[model samples]
Target chain A: MLTLDRHTYEAIVTHARRDHPDEACGIVAGSVGSDRPQRFVPMANAERSPTFYRFDPREQLALWREMDDRDEEPVVIYHSHTATEAYPSRTDVKYAAEPGAHYVLVSTRDPQEVEFRSYRITEGVVAEEEVQVVSALP
Target chain B: MAIEVRIPTILRPHTGGEKAVEGEGATLDELLADLDVRHPGLRARVVEEKGGTNQLRRFVNVYLDDEDVRFLGGLSTPVADGATVTILPAVAGGAGGVAGG
Candidate 1:
């Protein structure tokens, strides 16, 4: 249901790759009245090191509160794949709590070979969705 | 015919660190069954429980050659020769230091 422009998508990919080996995670927040989807705000993965990444619960709670204050929905959640390809781990499936939010992944093993994909994660199944990356803003 | 099944990074430890392995089957079910034979407990990881209308976990996504399997027929989806299937997890961003600011 959300649209991502090419520039914004590329920006996410670059950030994910820049933090290669360690996962990079961030949020995409949009104005409540905006016609198009939200813009990506890349952030450092505090729980991530060069080899591992664990989502920081404190940060996640803070983001939820901030978005609530702004009256804007936290549209999408994004993370990077360091040494591995852009794919979900069993742990990821077990922990996905958001049903409405779109989950995005960026593979950083080969910067030039960046892969961007999105999904809707539920109790135990990951449902894939089509992401439209346009050149111009709507 | 024999087809190569690619394992994602998370499942690599169970697959002996092999990225891709061989499986024989005419359909996805058969292929997965053979995969289970090679690597035990893999099917359980991919599919949590059978008989449910929706098989995949909400956070896990599977793609065949860049196309999502959900849009297709799901587990019943067919795989051809040399096709690459990727299983990806749904990722969300953390709150601090750069996001939601």
Candidate 2:
């Protein structure tokens, strides 16, 4: 299961809503081996197509390098689906290379309802996991 | 330089169901060519001609040591011995419709 603060979850939903039909993608970075998502890095959908999303080549390079320099890994790789269920498509499963990261999918198919789900995609298999949204402020 | 290339399950057919294969080259392009010699039609699926130039397919991503090759000089990226190369299909799909719910 993956756990994150409410603020982080809200941030992801906001990004998905902001991008709307084009599909939003980003990474939540955390300490290596920690499996905790502590930082959010919103990414540009290079494809900019409603049915597809790809990180900008240059930006992805820089961001990944930055994460490397900071000794962080992408703990959660998230993307939004504007018109579908919060599920990984066959293509999504095929491209999942990070075995250790939680793959989050948000569905903004309904403006009034947001569907947030998470999964683990390793090799050719996908397993849905539980998400614990906790309040950080106290 | 000898490098280990992690083959995705969909592309494993090209490697005779092998999950990983050995490749040798000074750069990614040469390395791909080396693999093609062993597995015919393997390069065509991953490589393509776009805008009159040959390049990796838009939907195919190749990474060297966790770094995407596109930002690392693309096909010219230098790959050293003992490095790990990963190949994946670029996956992008969702339901279809206009914006705003």
Candidate 3:
């Protein structure tokens, strides 16, 4: 149900690797026209944590505002699995309040072996889907 | 032999700001008990309930080396000598705003 081009996926993998050992978080914004259901604008996460990440709400709001200015909405919310697989954790499923938003997981433990997976997590059920990233913004 | 456990940022407050600590235990439970002796309230925060059936909060994640504890037999997983354990939390962006400002 979600498609991310190759380039976008690589970018996320790079970010996740760079933040190795620590959880890296971000957002993806895009316009959902009739032709394409997904578009993305990735943003960095700036929060201090020992064993968890907390997305800066203010930064997210600003991003949303910017997307609104551009007539687009935030389509996805993403983060990394530092030493884990690209699967949704129990907490991830429980906190996924936005049903419309795609949940992306980037595994950074093995950057060269990076895996990008998508999910529609709700009420502890995470339904994964394949995604394709494109060359240019769509 | 004793093993070293890496303390995550959230639990740093309890561990007296030490990023990693040493414990004398052959299993994960023994190591955690040893850690609790030095840093009280840590076991309660990391392990939820009395029986350790569930993890504390959803945000917290524990890993032995690069493997997640949830998928690696939960807390009962064995720990070898000098193995490294890491903990991380789930952070995501939503309808909220910046971190500090």
What are the candidates' C-alpha RMSDs?
17.2, 6.4, 16.1
The candidate 2 chain B region of ten consecutive residues with least summed lDDT is B92-101
The full ranking of all candidates by DockQ, starting with the best, is 2, 3, 1
Model 2 agreement with the true structure over B4-60: per-residue lDDT tens digits: 987865688799989789989999989999999998878887888777987887667
Clashing pairs in 2: B59-B90
DockQ, all candidates in order: 0.02, 0.23, 0.05
Looking at model 2 chain A, which ten-residue stretch has the lowest summed lDDT?
A56-65
TM-score of 3: 0.52
Per-model TM against the reference? 0.53, 0.69, 0.52
Error of 1 at B46 (Å): 26
lDDT of 1 by residue, B33-94 (tens): 77889799776667766465537553455566656677777778888777766654434332
Candidate number with the higher TM-score (2 or 3): 2
lDDT per residue for candidate 2 within A1-138, as digits (tens), equals 889999999999999999998799989999889888999988888878777777765566566558767988889999988878999987677566567789999999899997999999887788999999989622
| Superposition error at B85 for model 2 (Å) | 10
The per-model lDDT (C-alpha) reads 0.65, 0.82, 0.65
Which 10 residues in a row give candidate 1 chain A its minimum summed lDDT? Answer: A51-60
For the second chain, the TM-scores of the candidates in order are 0.74, 0.88, 0.77
Predicted candidate 3, C-alpha RMSD:
16.1
For model 1 the local lDDT of residue A77 reads: 71
